[model samples]
Target: GYTVHTVLEYNYVLAVEVNGSVVGYVQTEQVFDSAREEVAQRINYAGAGEESWTVEPSYQIAVGEQVLNENQMADAILESSSSEIQSATGLYVNGELVAVTTEGDRLRQELDNMLAPYQNPDDPNLTVAFNKEVRCEDSIYFTSTLVPVDEIIGKLHGEEQGAVYYTIQSGDTPWTVAGSFGISVDELQAQNPDYDFNSNSGFPVGSQLTISQAMPYLQVKRTLVSTYQETIPYETEEQQDSTLPMGTVQVVQEGAEGLAEITQQQVFYGDSSTPSETTIIDRVVVQEPVKRIVAMGQYVPAENIAYLSDGSTLIWPVPAYRGISRWMLGAGGKIHGGVDIRANYGTEILASASGQVTVAGYHWSYGNYVVINHGNGYQTLYAHASSLAVRAGQTVAQGQVIAYVGSTGKSSGNHCHFEIRLNGARQQPRDFFPNK
Candidate 1:
């Protein structure tokens, strides 16, 4: 219902006839004026002669032509909408064009397969679906285009703008970078072949790494109404006791962990790379926690361990182990006043010098620890012990087994935390040991 005009040659196309003789042609209006003026001069030169001109129409497609309307301009070329013309299946994610594949059955199968991993065989209440509504649309294509199934899937999983390079910055580890870009480490290594992923060393800063992945356009969302038991941590309570000695604590009751029944909705998106998130629907405590009760002593009793001058010097607490993982003081005067001696688990921890056990109990920083006072305003503390061989107010001879080494409290591994305090002040123990 509209007139479609096309220009073959836009420059000049006008036929000029002077006295029935074909002269030349001009296309523009200004050029036509000049040709007319020449024709008039020729007419004047030859009296009784007539001059006429006719516009020549050309119908050719070129840069000067305006054929397709604004609506059809996006196609760049007009497509046939006849009954004989057919289009393939188009995959769309949340109404966006994901891909167009020739095999509709295969595309639909692939979409169904994505949801298979999210299905729970045991849970009837589990609902698995696409996080973004995805569909293999039939015959929605306005153009004659068909992509291979593999290519369609690749494009569907790739970034909309294709591959890009990301500059590695400070604190940009492989895990953090991959998570930020929604890519996996294997995908990262696929592009960077030179990187040794097995090594623990980090990549250098100011380097460029290729990032070429996106979360699959269609994400399988799994929602399950689940019920599970949760743990309730016990609380610690301390009471004052005047009958016991100072720097000593006695446990009144042992603590026990409690349980709670929680009903929640577990929502997981995509594969195991992404963890399931929980939303508590209902919660009820099955068993209440029993608080840990300990009695803190206020009095230092008149009774004390008798002193003997048989041994006066300090002895290596952990025998057969000479590995000192850390020192008491570092360069530039960074002082922690304690040393970490690495040893096997359950290794004997001997008393450095003869003294009375002042503390043989649990501490927040030093678990199952022991502290001995050696009468001359000097004391020694052995922390992170597996078990105590001596208790508070008990006497231990020099080099006697007082405890066993263990990785407890805030320790990283099996190590003995040793420290010496002079009148309640911590001192450097580097010079106190016999070995250099």
Candidate 2:
């Protein structure tokens, strides 16, 4: 078959090829010169500048017979002659290659400059790092996506069609903002620190609330691990006082809540709507809880609040268990609802307090578990059991073998999960066994 372009008078064209595949053809000298200039301008980049060359420029150049435009010819030239251009340093955010730059040193300096404000001089513990998995890679890039540092910063905070804002309404509040956006107040406060949320008047109406943040592009995660003091709520303990008037109460000892020293790990994210994770590493009671004793003249028999476990009533359910692995509220401040006692598989799980077996069956989280009701608003639960020695509604005594430990359900290893409930509220089992 005779080629139509070959028969034409101006048949000689610049056929651009990259590694063997023809990208496009430059039919005119003017198109070729313009394309070459554009390609040179695009590839000759300095990493120190604001323009970021992130990923390779995507090309859609038609091969042969098709007349290439300026952009298309430029794409062809860039694709064909990349070895003459400088290599681009890629910036990967959270494992996704986002941007590239030729000025690697300048990019690194800019990133450092971006994160410099997060350092706390007064408290040296304040450490800030990229929340996303960020890394720099050196490779050849075709990215002609040039932009200023500000736009690149916008990219760091996630540029979803720019930023989104919520206009304050007649009854808009921080709490309401959280409800409307399905976000927490902490996240909202983090996003808008300039707003005086703690002021008595609060934010005025018609204010623009930044619902979606446009903060530093580092996607920063600021962490502070410190030991702080927190107040421990005082529990009221009532007793019979014959010296006081009848039907009247008096505080014999001025009740005061104690203070506890806690070592906690706190994490905060910038430019993200995600909630922060808090973990309690260790806690020590600086002061114990004081009971507000009130004396009533009308003498009535006192209810046995601690009859089942008198602050030391419940016996150790797993005698051969190694130790407690997890405590109530141990997982990042989330409710664990129980204490995990590390033990050998098939180890005997004894009843902590004498009670009737209320439930002995399989559960999604508990696996083969047993629940014992001690008849006095007190209940003990043993979970992740391999087998049950007692059935539901059966009577069991303290120290009696009720089940055996196993890694079942949501359990990670062979262990006995124990829980103590007072009037259906989960209590710290550590309080029941003071000595251990």
Candidate 3:
């Protein structure tokens, strides 16, 4: 008769195979039901397939009756088969599952031991014990380490743990000092609320103030005040019938003071006068000390003044004119804007004053023209020119050749139109010339 020998474990059967065919089998009940259920649940969660089952009755066993021979039937009894049970353990940290191993139970025990030191037995706030290892696919695996919530939150806020300090100085107003240091006055005041600007002055001569550094002020080349002076020969005619030789008077002193000082002096014979031996008449300073001093001021610093003529202050807009255009008051019948000298066609035009070339190209009716801005709102314009020699912004000296005269614009014949402007408004050029 076939009969069950012994029980092995839950969901497992054990059977003994004999030499030929007949075998005996037994069933086993698991002792750790909770652990087995956990493993089963993990396997189900892993989506593993179910195991196949087989059932067979011994041939010697009668239908629904007991075996007749006990020893012979024992050899023929059905063998109890047991599927190979494997223990799998996997570790998880921060909800991430890790590797599995053959020694699943040992790995699980090791993980449990490692977590035991950090475990808080009395911590009621902890809802679940940290799972270090878990059983998976008949093996043990590990999980990523978990960080404390408080630690993560602390990193997010960025807490400071260092000390900061600032120094105060004399002559230091809260606003200015704070600005120099690149910090706000409010911030400085907040840092040192007791700081008093009146009582605690910043700039104690050599005292250092701990503030942010700043770029130093730049030093630039600037023109001081500019001055100009021109000396011209003055003659006084004496009407006499005496038999005395016409004596020539030579200037012994050329005087200029302040901004323009007389560096040297030279005496020359006049065009119509001849040198005659004469007794010492009298040596005296005719003109008082003409002082022209230029001081550098904040507004309109002194710059190099342009000259129109070489060694002379007489400046003409065009190098030449045509048909003897006389100096008249205005334009035509108006005040004399400028002296119109006579010249033929293609006469070299010259700059009247030393200045920057402000207008050197052409105008609507003036034709090819040149306008020079002599600082201090003084300017000179040349018109009716055939060609321009200097460009705008070019520096020019008095009497410098700048163009050629011709009947280019609004001119009845070949001639040059000259005008002077003070502060962008037209002014009479005769006002600047010495009384002939």
For 1-436, candidate 1 gives per-residue lDDT tens digits of 2333333335334443333433333444455454344323322322332223222222221233223222222111112212212356767677555556678898788767767766777889789997777776554243334568988766545544545789888877888888888989888888788876668654667888888744454567888787899999999998888786543468999999999999988788766544468789999999999999998654432222222244456655765455888868765325555778888998878787789999999998798899999887779999998888999999887656789999778778898998877778776776565343
lDDT of each: 0.66, 0.71, 0.46
- The TM-score ranking, best first, is 1, 2, 3
Instruction: Provide the TM-score for each candidate, comma-separated.
Output: 0.36, 0.34, 0.27
lDDT at residue 1 of model 2 (Cα atoms): 34
Model 3 misplaced regions, further than 4 Å: 1-312, 317-323, 328-339, 434-436
Best candidate (score: lDDT): 2
Model 1, runs deviating above 4 Å: 1-122, 134-210, 244-250, 262-284, 299-436
Full-model lDDT, candidate 3: 0.46
Task: Provide the clash count, candidate 3.
Answer: 82
Total clashing pairs in model 1: 2
Report the C-alpha lDDT of model 3 over 79-145, residue by residue, as the tens digit.
Answer: 2222332333444334333333455455546545534543456753222232222332333111111
